[model samples]
Target: MRFPFARVVSLVVAVALLLSAVSGFFALFTARWRVASLPGTQQVANHTFTEQIIVGEYRTCVTLRRETPATNDSDVVQVRREENCYNTFPVNLFWSSRLRDVSTGEKAYFIGVCWINRDRVARVLGIPEDVPMQSLWKRQCFGVRSASVGTQAVAAAMAVIGGAVLIFDRNDKERPYRGMILIAGLTAALSLVPLVIWFGVVKKPGFDVGPSLRLAGFTWGIHLASFLALTLLHFCHSRSEMARYSGPPIDREVVTTQTADRLTPTQARAGQAAEGFARLESQA
Candidate 1:
């Protein structure tokens, strides 16, 4: 069955926004993950956590610099032999602090990592060593989208409202338009959030030639698609209204009552007869 064009548009937009924003976020995360995995990220310690790590399912220490010019993989291996607790794992989104144990000459590693699967994480690594990894996990997980729940809430409101405005009209007598508006607006606003997150909010760092550029190009497409959906909605609504009313074509005329001149002769005689009958009955 054919649904309202507005609803269709809103749904599509919402989907695109969700996919892209989520895609971009993951892209950003993936990019960060890529940065983490890059062979050269670690630098000489600055006394505490100065390196970036991932946040989510599995938190791992990342070298802070997106691509460090000075550091090499050989150097990392050499440094590992010297430090006992500083076992190198996969790199991620959060930054790690460096601390040296004076008594044991063991450099303690503290890098926050968010794993790929945020909802269901594997057995958390680094718990065995009594290193403060859990606290680190909490901090990194929240940053996956934004710092506060309020941001998502605001984005949700935007999607809800905008979708509503674009979808439903007040004059729709056939069905309740208000609820449609609520759903459409809600979805639209929510859909655009991911785009806002990736393209607008968090600008990922620039890196050298590879799949990263390709990903950036794809994200740009996502942004375009989102804006286009909104624009199409406006056009569709205007066209629909134009088709619906057709410039106030013909006004229906209201029919009113015309007064009768007088009663028919047959009606008058009948009335006289009825009066006589009533008088006779009363006398009897």
Candidate 2:
């Protein structure tokens, strides 16, 4: 049987999407325990720190995840410890940021907490009243700083590339589904901005660049696979539709039958020879 390449490709796409989503969550929350506030999630005002105006407003905005690791002990301990390591490695925040300081209106970079989602935002743009922004600024959060042109360059590049991928997929016969894939990917990629803004990685900005390369990579990977699948699917569909109306053959079918009435002496001799050979082999 032929290998299940289509199913295999689909599985690869599914796995990649799951991974992209998982990493997205990790970037959002820094860690399972660290405080975070996602778009729809409920926020529990963790804590607030006020130091100097320079630090801006910093607070431990906490949110929840569906599942978390209490400890490294589980039924699949070996698998968790060894294979498919998700939360073990360090998560970096510089890749995707939307940080800004209302006071100076800068990219707001905090020294010690620089890129690890630990950067102290000067004054977070959209903080719910339930979460403290003013008091946090008074308290010394990590000293926030501004986003450099290089960082901005990368963000702009990601968005442009993401857009280009979408366009190419449109004209491309090989990947008709590029638009849907890009939509999913860009949306997921954008999920990192709040952290960016909160972390002061991006300046009060134009285009408000999307997630960093790290997160973008996952979405892009899945997007490519999905785009290819969509293209193949459409191509197959077209071929099938064409086959339906292809019409019948212009020529009619003919059949021939064998009869004992016709036989030549040479043919009979050849037949006798074949029989003789078979009889000789059997006897031998």
Q: By TM-score, who's the top model here? A: 1
Mind giving the per-residue lDDT tens digits that candidate 1 earns over 63-171? 3222223455444422222212222223443544354432233554454334443211212221122223344344435563443223434544554454344444434
Candidate 2 weakest ten by summed lDDT:
79-88
Error of 1 at 110 (Å): 7.3
Q: Go through the candidates in order and give each one's C-alpha lDDT.
A: 0.41, 0.38
Model 2 misplaced stretches (Cα beyond 4 Å): 1-3, 31-201, 204-213, 240-245, 248-284
lDDT of 2 by residue, 60-125 (tens): 222222223345566432211110112111224433333443323355333223323322332343
